[model samples]
Target chain A: MPEMTYAQAIDHALGQAMAEDPRIVVFGEDVVMLRRELYVRFGPRRVRQTPISEAAFLAMGVGAAMAGLRPVVEIMMVDFIAVAFDALLNQATKIRAFSGGKWNVPLVVRTSCGGGYGDGGQHEQCLWGLISSMPGVSVAVPSNPQDAASLMISCLQSEDPVVFMEHKLLSDYWRDYLGGGSRKTVAFDVPENGRIGKVEIPVKPFPPGKGKVVRKGEDLTMFSLGVGVHRCLEAAERLEEKGIQAEVVDLRWASPLDRELITSSAERTGRVLVVDEDYSAYGLSGEIAAVLAENGLRPAFGRLGTEGVIPYDVRREAKVLPNAARIEQAALTLASV
Target chain B: MRMSAETVPVEELYRQMCRAREFEMALARLWEKGLISGEMHLGIGEEAVAAGVVAHLREGDAICLDHRSTPPLVARGVDLEALVLEMLGDPEGLCCGWGGHMHLFSREHLACSSGIVGSSAPLGLGFALASQYLETGGVAVAFFGEGAMNQGMLLESLNLAAAWRLPLVLVCKDNRWAITTRSRTVTAGNLARRARSLGVPARRVDGTRVDRVWRAARWAVERARRGRGPSFLLAHCPRREGHFLGDPMLRVYRDPLGQVLEIAPPLLRSLLARPLSRLASRVRCLGQIGATLGALGLELLLEADPLERSGRLLEPSMRARVEEEARREVEEKVMRAMERRVSRA
Candidate 1:
């Protein structure tokens, strides 16, 4: 087992998937060079470089799928998806159904997303929310390396189009954390059998559609996802000294919510505090609160929505997004009020 | 009038033109009777180009169709009844009533007919990319009107297809008119020359004659399939009908009514004024147009069987099936979205 960061974990997963399927292609702006140098062992065809035409390239991937090839087309930045939305939402996603199920578009589209990066508004927008709203698309935002690899492999194997969103910050920061603290750092490790390594399991799947308890507490249930989950966990750890036993839960899947798990947890804890980085209204937290209200868990929704009309300026964004301090305050408030 | 698998004859080309004209007339009738909805752009005099280009294509090759490509899709083996029913908004239509006439799709024939004006250009390039990636001996063709040359998507596609050396054929069916604007009035320079500037082999074909179009298209298709990269063909045809039914051509063009009136004199008087050569030319043109329409009528009769029968075309059971499919698709989309949100969150 080994301890690896989230980014390193993603690299490991990408390497593993590439090694498994020759049909799987990794392509984007600097992907051909970066992916090859990172993997060093793979050919230039499987890992290709492309000119900056996102729509056309994405369409090329779609066309490639119709002719029986699995492709992983990367949009270097998620913001570029705006230029290729037509191909992504119309051509690739609708090919199978449009053709009466004659062909499946088995392709993976990867992009780096989120607002923590100093790249400012254009580069750091977490637009997965908009993509998630589209049909015939599978969107994955892996916070850790284990998920990055597993989810990517699953996407590569699936017969549908998947939008894999990798957080640039995590890729740059979390390689060792994904290693699971292993003595030997092999090229990559799959979590199976005796191959278990030394990585902290911050949270695991407790119940479907429900948040998992990172810590058992009689006080408040702090619900969050993505980086918010990490922040909430940090807050829970700090609050342990104040004797405010905070039970932090990671709301993994956002769309086909594990409604049962969330509601049951809320009912068990009686008091609920939802946290998120996206804005307040219509965000995941609001949806969760609505779901709870409809299902009998009237928990307090303490959403620490980022404060900004626009998403430019990294310093301002940092001040806006839900951080450890905000999470701790929200948790304390839920526990007391 | 010679014909082969690789080439269409003049007489056959005439027949295709007639078919396009009659089919549009029939479609207009359907629309008037409230049997069809949405909008349609007819390809009447452009029949020679559609038949010519498509004749050179094989089973494995794919063609991207614009809004004005009904006859090509039909000739390529799309079911006429399904096409008609789709226009009628029936659930059993090609897109299960999701796409109307302009968005006809036939998987069995590998034809993708779309409504978006310049969308096919990129998709066709995609097919070329697919062919190159898979090492398949197949070519992808794009049938765009002259007006579409201005679209950024098509222009970009040209560069990409050439850069990748993809096996693509870009057929610019310059049917003289894009809606109301004549190609001469809107486009700059020559179509083939524009393609040549992009490093693609370009050719000009007499789109009024089927055999001429067929020969040029065949050569381009073969060249592409053999990995010679992309080709562009400018097919110069004409527009006999208005952009759509009820859209009188007189308003768009200068004095179409006056020209029709001028030509409405006694046949004998005109013949006497022109002598034997002039009379012969007039007779031949009229005969060609008539023969074309007759052939179209026959083809429709033969091809329109499935959509005609009252007991089967849109049976209650069929409607139910379509509903079930739509519901299934919607639910699947919703569930998948939910799943992604859950897992990603």
Candidate 2:
């Protein structure tokens, strides 16, 4: 078994999918910079560069999908998708449904989301709520390199449109921030050479709309996705040290939510803590709470997420985004309730 | 300059225009009767543009229409019954009632329409790019109004289509109005020149003249099919009717009754005749009677007789027969769909 970084895992998945399917084409602003090797390997036709026209290129992806070609379009930041909201919200998401399921828009919009590196308000946002709230589109928020690879593959294979979200801080540049030094590695079953090391991440068959219980416990169930999952895991470890055992569930996809897994977990634990990096108001955290309530699960519920507008300063951002300490605190409060 | 009828089939063009005109007139009647709900943007006078441009498109070719989508859908061979059912919120609609008049779509016809302004351009570009990649020799046509020229997305789509040399044709129906605001008030410079600056071949045509629109669209579509790139066409036509039926502003149209009389023949107008004495008896209030008389007069004059006129241009008996058949088909289908909805309930 070898270890791979999150960035490398995404690149590996894209390369493999593009190689296997001739219909796949990747295009976006500065995608060549991120996946240059794939560009050289697949040539310009498959891996192309696009202008800064988010609306046009994103819609081109939708049109391309309607024309029987699979397109993987990348928007540099999640916030920028707002510029192309007409295309993403009105066109890509509703094409199939509007066409009465006769038209399948098989496209993936890969965007970098979340904050921690002081990227400021415009660049850093976890808008999973916006995408997941809309029907006819699926959203994937991978927590680790292994999940990232499998989730990307699942998104590529889906018959509908998908918004695949990647957290900026979880990429290769944030390995140190992940508390993993240069030699640190996470072991997996599959072995492949990544930019950092032999890319070995346990290739699990994690289907879309499914949740994975990373840790099992009876005291409380913590639900998180994307980079917040890492924070939840660390918080769970810290909680164990204080004699509190917390179960952590990684919700991979937001839409077609894993209701069974989440409800069963809450039933077993009798308490729920939702940790999210997005804004607390009308966001993923509230959505999870609503889902739990709608399912008639009356567990003691608490939520930990950013309060308002994200700040640019590092110290302020740390307070705005959910951290391990905050998660633990929220969990303790829910347990007490 | 007057367009040559030899350039395209004038009779077929007339028939297509009549189809669009009659469909919209039917929609207006339905809307007036409170059967069809929601907003409807009628393309009563802009029929030539849709009929002409769609005449040159192949089955594999795609089209994205804007809010005033009835003309294009009718011209693109969409089933009138399905379209009406969709507008009526029937479950057996083209989109199973999820998408209304504005968001109607059909993959089989490779046609879609959006209520959002300036959305069709980018979506059409996508279709063109896919056709280019598949080497399918299909061109994507985007139908918008003069109002959409300023939209950043539409401009971006123009740039992208030109940059990639995608087989795209952008048709701007310059009706001079964008929902009451004159387009010229907001638009600066020339729209055709704007596309030309983006490296696309663009031309303006007389939108009322189907022959002229057909020539312009043919040149653009051929250029795209030959892999030359995108083309922009500005079809300068008239709105002819209000932005929507029953629009209060249309009361200001000069000789509105006279214009309506021109479209509806004397026979149909007589068929809708009602005694003023009976009308007064039904209405107790003078103001209500006045409003009722005005509405009835307009309804009698706007009875979609232009379709009969256009059909008579080819063969009067054949046209009447076709319309009768279509009326029966629409009525039967609508009844069946309504029954299904009731049973499900």
Candidate 3:
């Protein structure tokens, strides 16, 4: 079995996809550096670099997709997608729908998101809620390296536009914080003729809109995605020490939410806690709570996420964004209720 | 295919312009009758720019249009009946009624339009980039107004097209007004200068003169096809109508009913013209009468077959037959589409 970091997994997935399909082209600011080896391998034609023109390039991706090629546009930071909102929301998301399904935008906007290094309000934001709110586009948020690779492949293969979010915290730079570089790599079963060789590490097939219960228990179900999934697992472990058996469901994709999985989990546990890295109000947490309520499931619900402002300081962000301590406390409170 | 100014066809250009004009006038009439809902930005006076530039494009070439998009779509050879049905929110519209007049798209025609300003530039750049990547020899044309000159995205698109040497042509319809505010008041420097600053070749043409526009577009399209990067065209023209139909200013300047009455038979014109003026000022009773008369007159004009009305442009004997054939073809297509909608419903 081969061990690969989260960044490596994404690179591998992109390389494999490009190798299989000549139509796929990747372009973004600084993508040449992020995927330097792929650039060298694919050359300037397939893997191109663009000037700092997010709106133009992003819309270009939409145009390219409509014309005939599949384009993977990388927005260096998720928050910067705001600049390309017209392209993403108005153009890419609505093109197929607006065109009466006459045009399909096979575009994948892969962006790195999340707050941990105090990268202020402008740089760090888990905007899955915002992107998922759009009807036409699919939103994919992967928790681990294996899911990242699989989901990236899925996004590339999708006929419609997809926003693939990568949390900065899951990158190799924070490997030390994730347990002193001792992170376990899970590899998925690759197809026989897959471009990349089969590895020993286990891989999970991240089908769009399906979630997995990472740690199952009966006391309560903690719903989270991306980096929050890891935090929820840690919180569940802490709860286990205190005789509380918490179940953590990693919601891989946020848009076509795993309603049945959440509903069954909520019904069995009767207590739901949604810990999100995005804002609490009008975000994924509220959405999950609404889903449970709408399904006529009266579970004891508690939500924890960033409240109002995303702070620039690392300490404040840690306090604002959901951590294991907060998730544990929120879960315990929900269980008591 | 490189087209020189001498090779630009006048008859075809005239036909395209007439189609755009008649289509828009029909839509305006529909609006007046309360058959169409929502905003419609008609390109009544800007038909030349659309006809001229679109004539230079082939089937594979792409075009992205702005809100005042009807002219270009019509010029690009989109199904006329489909366009009207789309505007009417019919299910068989080009966009299946999902997108109204502003958001019309026809992949078969390689044409798309959106309500958002400054969007066409980037979108067109994408099409051009695809052409460059695929080596398809197709050029993408972006049609915008002077109002979009300041948009960061438009400027960025210009820069990118130049940087990558993508086959793109940016045609700016400088109608001197961006929805009532004179464009010059908000815009600084020259419109073409903005593109030239980004290392893109640019030219300004008289948008009202179809010949001039055709020649300029032909030159730009040739440059792009030859892989010389993007070219910016500033089309200076007039907005003969208000931003939308039923604009008070439009009526003040050019009243359809008034024009019809002016061109009416001698006795009817004299009698109606004098009384209509007296009645128009009475403010109460006469105002209502004037409104009814205007509506009635416009309806009568719409009923008078477009073929008969097109006699002004075509040879009187040949005009009626040609118009009848054209109208029947369009009507039959529209009827089939409507029947399909009914069957589906």
Candidate 4:
């Protein structure tokens, strides 16, 4: 097994897919810098760079997808999606349903989201809620390198649009994007050399929302997304020390959530706590509550997320974003033990 | 300028324009019968632009159209029956009832349409980018309205196409109206100049003349095929039936007396109840109605409809024959679509 950083896993996935498929093209602002080897391997046309035109390039990806080319576009920052949302919310999401399946938009949008290195509100955001609310988009938030690699492969093979979100803290490129070091401790351990992490969750193609229980217990279930899953794991370990057992489920795929996994997990423990970095208002936590309620599950439920606007100060950002202590506290409150 | 009729055969173009015209007229009739729901946009006037550009498209060429998409789709030889069924929301239709007339897709022709304005340019860029990378030797043509040229994405597409040297042709059918607003009132500068500034060779043509549009489209399409980047063409046509099939102002044109009687009483009442300072504005409203009615009357006096202009290019007897054939084909498709609906029901 090859050890991998989250970014290397993504690069490996791109190289593997492009090796097998001639239709894959990667492009965005400074994407060549991140996937430099891909640029060397796939040549300029396949790994092209574009002007700072998010809306046009994204829409072009949609058109390219319809033209039978699978374009994996990078959107520099998830905050930049604001300028290109018409492409995402309307064109990319509506084309399949509008074309009545006559067209399959195999467009994968790779973007970096999450905050820890003091990139303000504009630079850091987990807008999965905005996209997951739509009908025809699949969102994959990989918490570890292996999950990122597997999810990238699944997204590339999907017949529709998939949004692959990488947390800035975990992506290998973060070390170079700014002077910040890669948060290897924030993710699960990868093998020593080849960049493959230990977490191996099979991602169902397209609308993948399967949850992987990284740590199992019988007391209470804690669900989280992306980097927050690691926080949940740390919290679960602490909870175990205090004689409180916690099951940690990493909700890898955001949209079309695995209802069966969520319901059964909640039913088994009779208690549910959703910990995430996305804003709590109309976000992932709220969505999980709705899903559980829709499934008729009446468990003791608690949720924690960014309190409000993410600040520029590192300490204040930490206060707003979830940490292991907050997760443990939220879990203990829910456990009432 | 040399007449395309002198240099080329245009009976085929005339026929193409006729089919597009007739096909849309049939769609308008269907909308009138309430068989198709939602706001129906009919490409009743821009037949020349569609026929002219589509005539140059060959195997592997791709197209993306605006909301008024039937003209190009008809010219491209897409299954008319499938379009009709799709418009009628039949599951067996082209898009299985998911895509309505505004959101049509034809896999066989590699054609697509979107309700979003200015989308065709980006789509064309994408398709052309694919053609460039795959070496498919296919040219991607985008059909949009002049209103779309104002959008940032279209300009961005122009810039990208130039930078990438993608094989793309951008055709803007200038109907002089963005929905109900006059295009020039909201638009600034020249459209062709803007494209040219972005390094795209652009031309403006009289869109009602199929031969003129045909020649312009030929030059642009050829340039694209030669890998000379994109060309922007502005075809000044008219939305002969107005913005959509049932345009509110279209009623004012169709039934002036009835519309004035229905609207004026309230308008006059509000005017009298309002401050005298608003008298000029109130009177301008009535004048605008009269202007719309007068414009309709004026349009009837002129041979401005593209289909009629193109039909004149062929011999009268040949013109009649082509029109009859197109009419019969549209009727057959309409009947087939109806039968599909009945069987499904």
Which candidate has the highest lDDT of all?
A: 4
Model 2 per-residue lDDT tens digits across residues A121-175: 5556788887787878899998777778888889999999999988776775332
For B270-334, candidate 3 gives per-residue lDDT tens digits of 23432143332223332432453454345333433222222344455555554455456555655
lDDT of each: 0.62, 0.74, 0.74, 0.78
- Reference contacts reproduced by model 2: 0.00
Model 4 segments more than 4 A misplaced? A1-337, B1-7, B269-303
Candidate 4 residue A218 Cα shift, in angstroms, is 35
- Against the hidden reference, what TM-scores do the models get? 0.45, 0.49, 0.49, 0.53
Candidate 2 runs further than 4 Å off:
A173-205, B1-345
lDDT of 2 by residue, B1-345 (tens): 445655578677776786677677777766555455434568887787888899998879999998789888888888776787676656666766556666778989999887657889999999999999999999999999887786688998999999999999999988766543445544689999999999988999978777778888889999999999999999877665655554433542445675345323422322232322233322223232234335434644563333333344456666666556555655565556556656765
Looking at chain B only, the TM-scores across the models are 0.68, 0.76, 0.76, 0.93
Model 4, C-alpha of A164: deviation from truth (Å): 32
Clashing pairs in 4: A2-A194, A2-A195, A2-A196, A3-A193, A3-A194, A3-A195, A3-A196, A4-A195, A4-A196
| Model 4 residue B209 lDDT score | 90
Model 1 chain A weakest lDDT span, ten residues long: A174-183
Clashes of each: 37, 4, 7, 9
Writing each residue's lDDT as its tens digit, candidate 1 over B40-77 gives: 46776566677677777787789899878787875565
DockQ of 2: 0.01
Candidate 3 residues A93-117, lDDT tens each? 8888888888899999999888664
What is the alpha-carbon lDDT of model 3 when measured against the actual structure? 0.74
Question: What is the DockQ for all candidates, taken in turn?
Answer: 0.01, 0.01, 0.01, 0.01
